[model samples]
Target: MIASSNWKRNFFTIWTGQAFSQFSSSVLQFAIVWYLTDKTGSAMVLSVAMMMGFLPQGILGLFVGVFIDRYSRKRIMMISDSFIAVASFIMVIAGWMGILSTEVILVVLLLRSIGSAFHNPCLQAVTPQIVPSDQLTRCSGYSQAVESVSQILSPAVAAVLYRSWSLSGIVFLDVIGAFIAVFTLGITVIPELHQDENRGKVQVLREAKEGFQILRSNKGMLGLVLIGSLYTLALMPTSALFPLMSMSYFNGTSMNASIVEVVFSVGLLFGSLLLARWGGTKNRVYTIIGSFLLMSFSLFVSGVLPPSGFYVFVICSWLMGVSGPFYWGAYTPLLQSNFEAKYLGRVLSLASSIRLLSGPIGLAASGVLAEKYGVEKWFLIAGGLVLVAAFLCIMISTVRNCDNR
Candidate 1:
């Protein structure tokens, strides 16, 4: 039986806060990416801006998990959200004063990402503390569903608000959303990791090393992280190019790009609901493998199709969306079920960090490649790489047996 009748209450309390946070972030992301694309019309610039946003998360990820494990998860979230809000406030002022430059925008994004570096791992780490073991999958699926809803709304809202609202106006809305997240967080009581007396010295490097050591001991878990990392490397660059693909190749506008984003999120929402209901197959690893393969095929087809295939691209994006929930919902639970609670924050953080770091490498390469060849070709390459990664997971006994672990 589940531990408390109030688990649902607590979970929703935090989830609501997270939902608000994600929605606001998504709105700002669309605003920033579209603004950059509209202003520069250069793939390299987009890639650089994106790299700036994600790089801090990758760099600070190693140490942030240890902080999450040691500190109060609720407090971490509050502080991070506050930090992001403050960054947004600065941007709002800059936008209003007509002093907002590309450099300023990039700096704001970097600050916001550093906050996320701490917030994300803490959020993931606290999940297992609230939900029952068996219900973890359902909760993960529902969480993704909420996130998909946010994504769906963000682009559509941004598309509408883009022409009407000033940059400062949009940023002000984000500030309000952040405060809403903070308020919800304040009301929720999140469980924290307990430190044992006499068992701990204040050694950051040693504790960080211990996080890696936990993964080393669990070969299957380590393999899973590797598989996820490879998958991320393939997917990240392709995604970064989505806006360009719609606008440049398909000769569409911001509204069209937002349409594609909405369709993808709709598909994701449906997929997540399915997971929430079914809780997935008995073998979650197989499900993840299947998800990757499905996404790979869809991406490959997308790239192979011509510019006349904008509709086809939309369909492919939706199919990729369906696969996403199956992959994430199952993957989180697999890790939570397998790893000890004490080490999970570090483990999740390490996995996230490595995956994030790989993205910049792919982005750097894809920026050059996309500028030269085309964005479509990179999609093809990403799909092929993910396909190979799926096969590698199948061949490796440890990763293949991940669900059992």
Candidate 2:
């Protein structure tokens, strides 16, 4: 365990740096989506772009964990950040040359996703190393709050910058952010795990299989992972189509879309703060279940609203945002608490890969459905599926008994 006094300094030092990178990435992501929405209004195109962003992580994440457990996580994070910076710089060059096609954008997303496959799991694995177990949920809440702050600012900044600046200029911010992340990581002192010399001799596939076995041994955690995958299956499509729902369904402008994004993130910030202070309900599983119900209600109501109900839709969006941190805040800490430190990397990575794989499936179906039946209908479908998933969580004894065990 980390010394009580140094834990905050070590965790926050790296976290504050990550916040800068996240803010820049959020800005760039908004710019890319808006650009795609304006250039090609097709739901299929947007879905494809979103798929490219996560598919690599889904495919590679299963194996990435083996290395995270065996190698220096700090080194992996620094290298990953550097790799993403280079990818963003490539986009900057492409934009400057006026050759920034959708294909080019997808390629950048792929490269960035590959980097994130390593960085994200490494970061999660590092958390328990540096922080006390009892404080994990609070730290997760604080982490979410920092991310929400970036989300809150990024959309409005992207909207204004997108209007005044070129794509290359917007992307350059990511390069700078990555540099800062790498620098802070270089200076921070993260305690190293004791490495087993013989462990590296094991085959990667065998190690991955062991990781799977470790996760499978915990029936409740395994069930929770499945529930999360189902939730992502329902959530991703609606999230992918959010811009179209605002512009196409509601007949709104880019500014209006930004307003929706900003308000939703503001709600996230509020919820994160609440979770940080309260540390959630006694049973974290119940906290997650409540979030699911709240989100289902919001999405369902948003779907039923008239075209002139843009304002109401915005409120629903905020409610959806508010529910987000509760689920993630509870969910992450559950994983951290239940698993041993050595196995956390593989467990988190595998779980993330499973959940992410479901997203492309959802996005694919959503594109066809939204393009044919209209985006508003997807809100209804997604809402219904989430409600079902929540009920499943309630019915499953293993999931209900997870935290208690």
Candidate 3:
């Protein structure tokens, strides 16, 4: 275990390295999406590319947790980072050869997604081992802030680099970033979970099943997970249609859309910093419930706005972004606090899988509903659903007292 005195040093070192990796990856992703759009204007291709990126995580999340718990999480993280680096290198090669077809790009995206399937969970599982339990929410907030910074900067950076540099050149940054992550991880001391000598004899599927049982046995956690899933389901459509809402309903320009995006990211950064400072309410559930109400209110107001109310819509978007960290910042730590360290990998992965799967379902519905009815109408629907979900969470006593347990 990391010593209390060294915890901040260890955690920040690792976090700084991961921040670099995340920024580079975000730039690479932006490049890939732009390349695909330029090559094929079809939304189908874009959707398919997105699915390729998410499918592995959604499907393999059920199983990867077992390996994460049984083996060296540190090794898993290094290997996953290395794997992603190699994938980016392959993209670099393909880009230079003038053979970076859509198929090749999609395949590389799949490979990166597979690597993330391992790396993300391992990182989550490793956090509680290094940081004090009481500080998990603060750490989560800081982490979110780092991600928000990347989100805010990446698009503009990618746009400039894509114009001035070759795609391969931009992708090579990911290689460097990954190397830094692996090296920093190499130096950091992450305590490993104690494993039974007979653990190797256990079937992977059985272990995965055991993880599910653990979650199932906890009625409150399960309800929280379900509520989170439903929230994602309602929120995804609005998220997916943000650009459309800005341009179509508000009759705004591309610049207006970009402004909305930037403001939202700024809000995320602000909220994350706020959460880090406050550590949220004594009961994190109250923070989450408050976030849900705030987001629901924002979305509902966004939908009802007239075209002339574009500025108000932008403010609403910012409010929605601000709500993000309070919900996730609290929710993740809530899980980390409640679950045993060994089982957390499985629990987090399963929850992640459910959340990931719900997104595409919502996206699929979004395009159709936004097409037939109107984009703004879906926001109203999404807002109403979230309000209902929040009410359910409040009524569920087990969830209310989940943190206490």
Candidate 4:
């Protein structure tokens, strides 16, 4: 009971720190994205930068998960946070010296992405150890709510800071946020999963293979992972192109771009709050599928609308935001409940890596597609593909029956 109480306390403590960390990082992200848009005005440059940001998470997550399962999750998070701070500090120095090249920025983004590769899977794996089964969905919702708030604030903050402050100033804030996050982790105690006393020494490669085997043996889970991979592929192009679309298609300024971001985040916050209160349906898979369909429809409608329909695009963006959390809230908790805590780090990490690999692939192509076919048309194509993927999942017996399993 004492351990249980401590777990609750630690959970909140860590969560609060992470919220600050997320906010700062998000601010830096938007500032960089806007800077790229303003400086280059090229879809390809944006895509390449976005790819740099996501590629490490895709490549390193598989190995990072194995480490998470073997070591202390709290330590992993602290180290990852510190790593990010160091990278940010370097970026700040570069910006100060006026030697901040695109290559330097890409390097920092890669380092930050690597830190995330270590941090994220551990964060997800630890939740099951701390929270009760019945409350997992609510916790997921609350987490999304916090992230939404960060998203809501970060863009506006970036917009304001970009007008007056140097890029280094925004990055300095990220360093401070990382310190706070690490400090909070220092104060909190995260429970570790104990290995059986009789068990022999473990092998990471074998265990990783086992992680793959677990998914392969479970057809439903495999199908779900495949669907998630496809979803990531479909969504990346749209997300990476949104800034370009706002500036070029809508004739908007950076402030206007931030406004759209804020609106979508507002919708995210609303949806997260609703899910937190309602806890969603018993069949979370259905909720996931439904979210996909809703988002795809919104994306399609937004893509087809004329540039004069910018207001309508805002509404669709809001719809996309709401559906995103709904999908994640259900999807994450499902994985938590289905997988054992022992293997969760590797299982979840490998799954995350697989899904994330699609990001760079789509992002790389998205630039060319946007350049050739226009950003609006790319959105329509992505939406149509996502819709098809979701429908196929609904029809697949293995995936459809997984919720029952």
Across 58-89, the per-residue lDDT of candidate 2 in tens digits comes to 99989999888888889999999999999988
- Per-residue lDDT of 357 in model 3: 87
In terms of lDDT, which candidate is strongest?
Answer: 3
> Clashing pairs in model 1?
none
Task: Please give each candidate's TM-score.
Answer: 0.92, 0.93, 0.98, 0.90
lDDT of 1 by residue, 253-344 (tens): 87778778778889999889999998987878887888899989998998898888899999999998998999999888988888877887
Residue-level lDDT of model 3, residues 1-58, one tens digit each, is: 5789999999998998999999999999999899899989978888888899988998
Which one is best on TM-score? 3
After TM-score superposition, the amount by which residue 402's alpha carbon in candidate 4 deviates from its true location, in angstroms, is: 2.3
lDDT of each candidate versus the true structure: 0.84, 0.89, 0.90, 0.84
Can you tell me which runs of candidate 3 are displaced by over 4 Å?
A: none
Candidate 1 Cα misplacement greater than 4 A, ranges:
36-44, 96-98, 197-201, 247-256, 371-374
Compare candidates 2 and 4 on lDDT and give the better one.
Answer: 2
Sorted by TM-score (best first), the order is 3, 2, 1, 4
Question: For model 2, how many clashes?
Answer: 0
Off by over 4 Å in 4: 1-7, 34-45, 95-99, 196-204, 247-256
The model with the greater TM-score, 1 or 2, is 2
TM-score-wise, the better of 2 and 3 is 3
Clash total of candidate 3? 0
Candidate 4: Cα lDDT at 71: 77
